[model samples]
Target: MVAEGAVFTTDRTVPIGAIDRWCSALLDELAGVERELWLVVAVTLVVDVWLTHVGLQHGLQEGNPVMRAAIETFGFAVLGLTKVAALGLAGVTRRLLSDRRGVVVPLGIALPWAGAVVVNATLLLRL
Candidate 1:
C-alpha cells in the first residue's frame, strides 16, 4: 500500500535509513531485556532443582516420604512457572510478528536461540 515515493520516507522528511537505525536501536534494547528474562528463568530453574534435590536427600535421611513428596511438588510448581513464562514469551513474539509497526522480524529473529538456551539450562539443572 506504500506509494513509490513514500516507500523510503519518514515524517515526510527523514529518510528510511533513519527509521532503520531507530529500529535497530530499539531491537538492541529489547535484546538486552530478553537476555535478562532468560537469565532470570535460568537461575530460578536451577534454584528450584537444587532445592528439590536437597529436600529429597533430607527426606530420605529422615525417612519422611510425605516431606519428599511435598518438596517434589513445590519444585515442579517452580518449573511450571518457567513454562508459563515461556508460553507468554511465545505469545508476545507472535503478536510482534503480526504487528503493523514492523518490529517483529528483528525480534523474532533474535529470540529463538536465547529462549532455547534458557529452557535447556533449566532442564539440565534439574538433573
Candidate 2:
C-alpha cells in the first residue's frame, strides 16, 4: 500500500495533475539515446528472424547450437520468446548501469543479430 502522500495512490483527493506529472516524468526518463538504442535492438531482432527464416528455406541453418535446439523444439516462435528475453535483459541492464553504459546492452544484442543478418544474406546469395 502507498503512503497517503504518495504521488500515485488510491486517495481520490489527489489532483489529476499529480498523476499526469508522474507519467510525464516517467516518459521523460524513457526519452533519448537509450531509447534509440532500444529501437535498433528491436529492428535487428525482426530482421534477424526474417533473415533466419529465409536462410533456412534456402539450405542454410541456425549457427547457434542452443538456438538450433530451440528452433527444433519450438520452431520459429522461439524468436519471439528470445526477443522478449532480450528486452528483459535490456531492462535489467537499464537498472544496473547509467544511461550511457546501458546503451551497451542493446548494442550487444543488436550487433550479433546484425552480423547474423550479413552472414545469412551472404549464404543465401551463394545458394
Candidate 3:
C-alpha cells in the first residue's frame, strides 16, 4: 500500500556481460567513425597534392616554415612525407575524439582541413 503523494522507485543494476556488450558496440561505432575520418583524410591528401602541384605551377610557396624548408631541401619526397604526417595526425584526432566526446573535437579535426581546402581552391582559381 502507498500513501497519496508517496513516490516509489526501483533500482536495477546492469549485468556485467550486458555492460561489456554495450561497450563493445560503442567501440565498434567509434571505429566506424575513425574509418570515415581516415577516408576524409585520404581524400584531403589527394586534394592537397593536386593543390600543391597547382601552387607550384603558379610560383606559390609552402607557407609552413618547416614544410617550406623540406620542400626547398628535399623536394617532393618531403611533400609526400608531410601528407603522411597529416594523415597520421588525422588518425590521432579520431582516436582522441573516440576517447572524449565533445563538439570541439570534431570541429578541431575539421576546420583546419576545410580551411586548407578553401585556401587551395581559391589559389587555384586565382592563378
Candidate 4:
C-alpha cells in the first residue's frame, strides 16, 4: 500500500515504504543545508579576518573607518568581537524571518565576506 509522506517518482515498481524513507532522508539533508549555511558564514568571516590580519601585518590599511579605528585603538582582537556581534545579529535575523527563509541571513553575510577574502587575497598576492 502507498504510505504517508511517500515521494512520487516515475518508477512504479518502488515500494511506497521505501519512497517515504527516501523522502524523509532527503528532507533531513535539506534541513542540514540550512544549518550549514550558517557554518559557511562563520567560516568565511574567520577567513576574512585572517586575511585582513595578514594584510595589516604587511602594511595594508583597513578601508572601513570604524574597523580601522577599532584595530588602531583596541588592536586586531576587535575583529573577533565584531564576528561575535555579527553572528548575534544573524541569529536575531534568523529568528525574525520564517524558518526556511532565514538562509538569506547567512548568504548575505557570507557573500560579502567571501568577496572581501577574494579582494584581500588578491592584494596580498601582489605584495
Question: Which number leads on TM-score?
Answer: 4
TM-scores of the models, in the order given: 0.28, 0.66, 0.58, 0.71
Q: Which portions of model 1 miss their true places by more than 4 Å?
A: 1-32, 60-127
Candidate 3 residue pairs that clash? none
For candidate 2, write residues 1-127 as lDDT tens digits. 6688778746568776998888666555644556686787788888788888888777677898999899989998897688788779778977898754455676678787788778877888888
Q: Which pairs of residues collide in model 4?
A: none
Per-residue C-alpha lDDT of model 1 across residues 1-127, encoded as one tens digit per residue = 8776765546467776998899778766665566555455455545444544454454422123654465466744544454456657755765666344334533453355355445544555565
Query: Residue-wise lDDT of candidate 3 within 9-117, one digit each (tens)?
Result: 6877778799878867766665557546546656766777778868877898877788888788888668877777766775576567645342234445455766787
> What TM-score does model 3 achieve against the real structure?
0.58
Candidate 4 off by > 4 Å: 1-32
Positional deviation of residue 124's Cα in model 4 after best superposition, in angstroms? 0.7
Where does model 2 exceed 4 Å of error?
Answer: 1-32
Total clashes, candidate 3?
0
lDDT, candidates in the order shown: 0.52, 0.77, 0.69, 0.85
In model 3, where do residues sit more than 4 Å from their true spots?
1-34, 89-109
Q: Looking at candidate 4, what is the lDDT of residue 32?
A: 64
RMSD of each: 14.8, 14.9, 10.2, 10.7
